[model samples]
Target: MKKEFAVIGLGRFGGSICRALSTEGMQVLAIDKDEEKVNEFKNIASHAVILDSTDEVSLKEIGISNFEHVIVAIGENIQASILTTVILSELGVQRITVKAQNDYHEKILNKIGAHQIVHPERDMGRRIAHNLISNNILDYLELSDEHSIVEVKAGRKMKGKTLIDLDIRANYGCNVVAIKQGKSINVSPMADEILKEDDVLIVIGADIDISRFEKNLVIDD
Candidate 1:
């Protein structure tokens, strides 16, 4: 069977993806134009190769089209990134996720048929900003442009309240999917379960609603 993923680049973003996928025991082919990078991941990925991904014939020789998902992570070089994404699209890679260096790069990638375009730096900036807003917000993940999932500490405002008493879903339009205290996580927490100051609530909803929910209970405290 073909590898499940192919990552074409060895920069911070691409290398991180390769490491995570490999750590998950997935079959990943790590490709890069730099020999040193290929050597670094030699034992990590299912296969590591030093090749110019922008060269169509080079990609075909390595059977790039066979991978179920291909990530174009050529760093800095917008030209190479666009060319590789275009070739991957033409080769009918089932899923092509490309890292956009900037807005212009994203637009060109979209025009050429990139299945998904990621702005890692931009997204990370948002995540950092959210975390900086208040110490109570432990983490944040963007589900979509308008939707997000946040892990926030239950502060003084929520310390003695129960899920139902707080009417989180009805009033805030956010769902408390889980609660964690210490190392224990309650994935299906009951509505009557009283919260503690140390509890961390994993909530998911529209970004605006989540912000409103946070402002009242988190920032207000």
Candidate 2:
């Protein structure tokens, strides 16, 4: 069955989620106090409404608590975001994800029982910075403050080299979890597996170790 989702605050983050969920065939209800924003998602989402999400009465009228998941993407107005999150928690919503503007806002959201807190701007900045620093790094996923998983394209140094010959784990303290060649993915790649120049390696390790591996192995040109 398709999960039901309600996205409050039809800003960039919320609107994007609404459209994505709708595209995946899930039911999405888009809400915002801005009439123009609400109307913008009318055709994209299952339903769209202009309402003040911070008001408990307004939320109850729209039956917000019935949705399986609710995303509060209120931008700038931290107070409104917190209030809306508090109401959703009190109403026993199954899951509530909120976009936090800062550390203090995130702390308040956590205390109010938000299921997940997203720092989209901060996370995206990190991803872009990592990509810029390493030309071979195709993508980066931050697992924690100290750890990350990165996808790096195999460079000339890695071409035709078997995993055992490279001894990557012992040398760099990073593990190659998978290798992607064109459309195929080899999960838990064998030690004898030869890496091709076009292969994409999915590696995981501590941030510092990953940096060392990228600098020593992955090349720009």
Candidate 3:
């Protein structure tokens, strides 16, 4: 069954999501107050409307509650974002995802019953910074304030060493969740599986522990 989604705000983040979801064959209703923004997405989305999302009447008129998931991606206007989320919650929207500007915004959205909160800018900044600092670190994701998941290339020192021999969990307090070799991925790799020099390890642990493991694992040529 095809899922129905509503994306409000029509800013870069919201507009991109609407286009992507529509491309994936999901029914998407794109809403924005700006006529220009709505017109831009008219050809891409299932439906595009120019209206104030904070207005409960307008939301109801568009059948917003019928959507399986609704994304509030208002940028710059914190008040509008909060109000929209509150109205959606009150209307009994099945799932609501909100883009928050800061910690305070996230707290209010959470309190108002937002199902998910995304800090896209902060997450992207962290990922870019991590990639810039370490050449061996391919990617980084902040799972929480204290924990992270990272992808790091296996160093020469780690070549031909089985998971039991490395004992990453016992030594570095991190778990190797997956191994990426060429185009193939081995998720939940066995302890006896050997790692090659070019293998990429997807590891998850506390930030401090992950930092420690990265420093110890990567060696300059």
Candidate 4:
């Protein structure tokens, strides 16, 4: 069966998530307090409803807790977001993800047992910053505040070196988890495999370690 999902809010963040999930062949229930917002997503989501998510009775009526995953994307309204999360937790929802406005909002959501917390804007800003600072970094994904997975184009310095020669893990504390060349990806690449300038390395480690690796090998003068 397709995994079921519920997204509460029709703002950019929530709307984008709903669209992406639906595109992946998932059943998504989109909810927003505004009638217009709900109507906007009527055709995009499996079901779009205009309802106050803070009301536990309404959530129960709609069987929100039965979904495999629920995302609370309520914007600006911190109180409603917290209350909705609390209700979902009490109802024993399997997984609940929420977007936090700031640190304080995140703390409350954490205390209330939100399964995942997303700071989309802040994270995107950090990713953009990383990209701007380095030409070799193709992409960056934050696994946490201090750790990230990065895709970097192998530079001239790394072109002729093997994984063993680089000794990246031992020296930089980062792991080159995979190597992408043209259309193929080498998963768990062997230490003897030579790197090419055009190769893309998928590396994961602490931010500090990644920065060090990027500086020493991925960047060209």
Highest TM-score scorer = 4
Model 2, 137-174: lDDT tens per residue? 89998887799999999988899999998898999999
Regions more than 4 Å wrong, model 2: none
True-structure lDDT of candidate 2:
0.92
Tens-digit lDDT string for candidate 4 (1-221): 99999999989999999999999989999999999999999999999999999999999999997999999999999999999999999999999999999999999999998999999999899889878877888999999879999999988889999999999999999999999999999999999999998999999999999999988988787
On the 0 to 100 scale, the lDDT of residue 201 in model 3 is 94
**Model 1: per-residue Cα lDDT at residue 66:** 85
Query: Which residue segments of model 4 deviate by more than 4 Å?
Result: none
What digit string (tens of lDDT, one per residue) describes model 1 on residues 62-122? 9989899999988999999988998998999999999999998988998998989899999
The residue pairs that clash in candidate 3, if any, are none
Lowest lDDT 10-residue stretch of candidate 1:
212-221
Considering summed lDDT, which 10 consecutive residues are worst modelled in model 4?
126-135
What TM-score would every model get versus the actual structure?
A: 0.92, 0.94, 0.94, 0.98
Model number with the top lDDT:
4
lDDT against true structure, model 4: 0.95
In terms of lDDT, model 3 sits at 0.92
